[model samples]
Each structure stands twice: as C-alpha cells, then as structure tokens.
Target: MKLRELRIEKGITHKQLSDDIGVPVRTISRWEKGESDMLLKNAIKLAEYFEVTLDEFINF
Candidate 1:
C-alpha cells in the first residue's frame, strides 16, 4: 500500500495519524505492513485525511 509513503510524505507518525483519525496505532502499523486489511470506512477516512481520492489512495 501507499499508506506508509503518504504518511511519511505528510511528516506524521503512526501514533499521530491514529490519534487524528481515531484508529489505533497498531492498526495503522498492521495496515502499513500488509498484515491486516483496512475496512472501507477506515480507508475512506484515510483518503480524506490525506486529501486524496479513494482511487488514488488504494492504487499502489
């Protein structure tokens, strides 16, 4: 996923993102590591948080 790249480009840590988006840090980490899948709602939240379209967010 492009999640880690986007988060780094935005200069925010996982904890910061989790706090801002109300997701847990471990969940963010798991998502980044590809160890877990994100729900559509969380994905939408992330897309909105990063100011990207859902397509852009999901596209590699």
Candidate 2:
C-alpha cells in the first residue's frame, strides 16, 4: 500500500505518523505525494510501526 493508504488504514494522521517515525509531517506529506523517497532506516521504522512488512510498503 501507499504511504497515505497505510496511514489511513492505521488511523494515523500525518503528524502522528511523523512523531512515531521521528520525521516531520512535511516529510510524510512528501512521502504521500511521491515527491520523496523512503530511506532504508525510515522505511524499516514505518513498516515496524505499521506492523507491516517492508515488501508491503515497497510493493505498493
């Protein structure tokens, strides 16, 4: 799933996700908009936080 999709499905706001992942909401916004790439560390953190696999994040 896309970042936005995962965020929504997990009932997490941009700010919440950012706080959880130690990033700014604007960064999350960029991610959702496909304007930036997910680095390896952040991607792993996001996957772990969402209880999803890296493949789920990447394959979407």
Candidate 3:
C-alpha cells in the first residue's frame, strides 16, 4: 500500500505520523504524495511506528 493508504487504514493523520516519527509534517505529506523519496532513517522510524517493514513502506 501507499503511505497515504496505510496511514488512513491506521486512522492517523500526516501530522500525527510526523510526530510519531519525528519528521516534519510537510515531509510526511511529500512522502505520501510521492513528491519526495523517503530517507533511510525516516523510513525505519515510519516502519517501526506503523508496525511494518521498510520494504513494505517502499515497495508495497
């Protein structure tokens, strides 16, 4: 699933996700929109927060 899809499925907003992962809200928005690449550190954080794997975030 895309980032947006996963986030919505989890019932969380972009700002909430940013807070969970310590990234800026804009960056999370960009990631969801495919406007920017996810950095490794941020990806790991996101994966952990969402209880997913890094590959799931990148490739699912």
Candidate 4:
C-alpha cells in the first residue's frame, strides 16, 4: 500500500507517524507525496511500527 493509505488505515496522523518513526513531519509528507524516497532504515522503522513486512509495506 502507499504510505498515505497505510497511515490512514492505521489511523495515524503525519505527526504521530513522524514521531514514532523519528523523522520530521515534512519527511513523512514528502514520502506520501512521492517527492522523496524513504531510506532503508526509515522503511524498516515504518514496517515495524505498522506491523508489516518490508515487502508488504512497500507493496512489492
């Protein structure tokens, strides 16, 4: 799923996800907007937080 869709499905706000993932809100925004790519480290953090595998999180 897309970042925005995943976040919304989990009922997490941008600020909340940012705080949990230790990234800036702008970074989350950029990710969801497809303006930037998430580093592997950040991607792992997100996958863990959302209880999904890297493949699932990335929809790959």
Task: Compute the lDDT for candidate 1.
Answer: 0.94
lDDT of each: 0.94, 0.86, 0.82, 0.88
Among these predicted structures, which one has the highest TM-score? 1
Q: Summarize candidate 1's per-residue lDDT along 1-60 as a digit string, tens digits.
A: 589999999999999999999988999999999999999999999999999999999995
lDDT of 2 by residue, 1-60 (tens): 488898898898998888877899999999889899878989889888888899987876
Q: What are the TM-scores, per candidate, against the unseen true structure?
A: 0.96, 0.91, 0.85, 0.92
lDDT of 2 at 29: 96
Query: What is the lDDT ranking, best to worst?
Result: 1, 4, 2, 3
Indicate the residue-level lDDT of 57 in model 1.
95
Instruction: Kindly report which residue pairs in candidate 3 clash with one another.
Output: 1-60
lDDT of 2 at 5: 91
Tens-digit per-residue lDDT, 1-60, candidate 3: 388888999999888887877889998888878789877887788778788998887776
Name the Cα RMSD for model 1: 0.7
> What's the lDDT for residue 44 in model 4?
87
Query: TM-score of the candidate numbered 4?
Result: 0.92
Worst lDDT 10-window in candidate 2: 51-60
Q: Model 2: how far is 55 from its true place, Å?
A: 1.1
